[model samples]
Target: MLTIGEFAQLTHLSVRTLRRYHDAGLLEPARVDQASGYRYYSAEQIPAAQVIHRLRELDVPLPDVQRILQTPDPGTRAGLVADHLQRLEDQLERTRAAVTSLQRLLRPEPATLDVELRAVPATTVAAVEATVELDDVLAWYSGAMAELDALVGTPGPPGGLYDNELFTTGRGRVLVHRPVTAPPRTGRVHPVTLPAVELAVTTHVGDHDTIDVTYGELGSWVVEHTLAVAGPVRETYLVGPRDDPDPTAWRTEIGWPVFRLAPG
Candidate 1:
């Protein structure tokens, strides 16, 4: 038998912490004194306490640590831990995105702008497009991209197509598009030709969530440069949130069809 203090010494956990764990039903003492109301632990309980300590050190929540301790099978324990590690990785990625967004907003210099006009050739593409509510755009895009990749079975880079109404109307019509040499089908799965057109384009770096500001800025620039808006805007996602998972490294190109403004 080990006294509470001795158990604490063996586990290298403080007495108060042990008592709290006991109160929380996490680590219970082996026996308690009837008259004196003192707690005592068996030598065998030391290992359990040590395990709990290690888990807490890893920043596992108390509830999760309890689950881990209660889980008997080694495979089950491994799976639980793996799930937690993946969650941590996702959290780290979100934190990095937040940091990048903050830095871009706080930067001192005016971001130097680049604008180009190019005529692209008409091409057939394998595309999955939908009209999605603004709030559900991200979720819808992920599913569409997954479906496109599954059908195309291409591990190479994928591209995107964005219709202008999504921004102007607050209801977005977007496409997760991948260029394919062959023809496409429609109404769920199909190939469509993206007709060749002249585009006025500008590149923006950062997460798409905040990239709209850049889009607006560029729209204003096109007007200032005496470019006439001819057709809807198209955003080609060059590098996505999935590629780097760091928003700072994400890049998107915003292009709008334009014709020269007749001398006004």
Candidate 2:
């Protein structure tokens, strides 16, 4: 038999932690002196103490550690630890994504863009229109684009119209259009005349994660040059996922419907 201090020395766990473990019924001593209230651990308990120490270092919850210790079956004990490890991995991924977003927000690179004001003539298009929640936009867009591609057969680079309410409210209307020589009238694909409008446009080169930064810069330019937004925002995919799998080579034109302010 080894004294509590000896067990602590062997396991490298502090005396205070061993005492707390005793109180928590995690690593009870092999024998306790009733008169002096002293705790003593046997050498056999050293392995269990070491396991507890490692689990705690990994940030495993106390309840989970207790479950692992109380479980007699080796497979059940391993499963408990594995489950917590998986949770830690998931949390690490989320932390990495958040850090990337924060870095983009705080250290923005200087933007050099050419903003143009042009009038787009009315045109007929084969389109898929629907109302979608912001959270579902990505999945919805993927399916919508697939359907449009199958129906239109690569008519032109695909584009989308996003209503202002989509940004203001949680859900709004979205229209995915493909420019075609002759608009088709098929299931969920119909001919629609897109109204003519003047736009303040800028190109977003790369992935959508940082596309908001480009939008902010373009919007600021519009206000500085005295332009008022007129209608839903338009996105023209000049070179996109359909053309290239590499996001670094993707090019999208973000067009905000705008009208010049009258001279005061």
Query: Which has the greatest lDDT?
Result: 2
Model 2 pairs in collision: none
- lDDT (tens digit, per residue) of candidate 1 on 34-143: 99979999998988998889878878899898898889999999998888888888888778767766776678875867888988788678888788887788788788
Clashing pairs in 1: 166-172, 184-191, 185-190, 185-191
Worst 10 residues of 1 by lDDT: 180-189
Cα displacement (Å) at residue 254, model 2: 0.4
lDDT against the true structure, per candidate, is 0.79, 0.88
Candidate 1 global lDDT: 0.79
Q: Please identify model 1 stretches exceeding 4 Å from their true place.
A: 1-20, 33-38, 118-124, 133-139, 149-158, 162-171, 180-182, 191-200, 204-233, 237-251, 256-264
Estimate the TM-score for candidate 2: 0.67
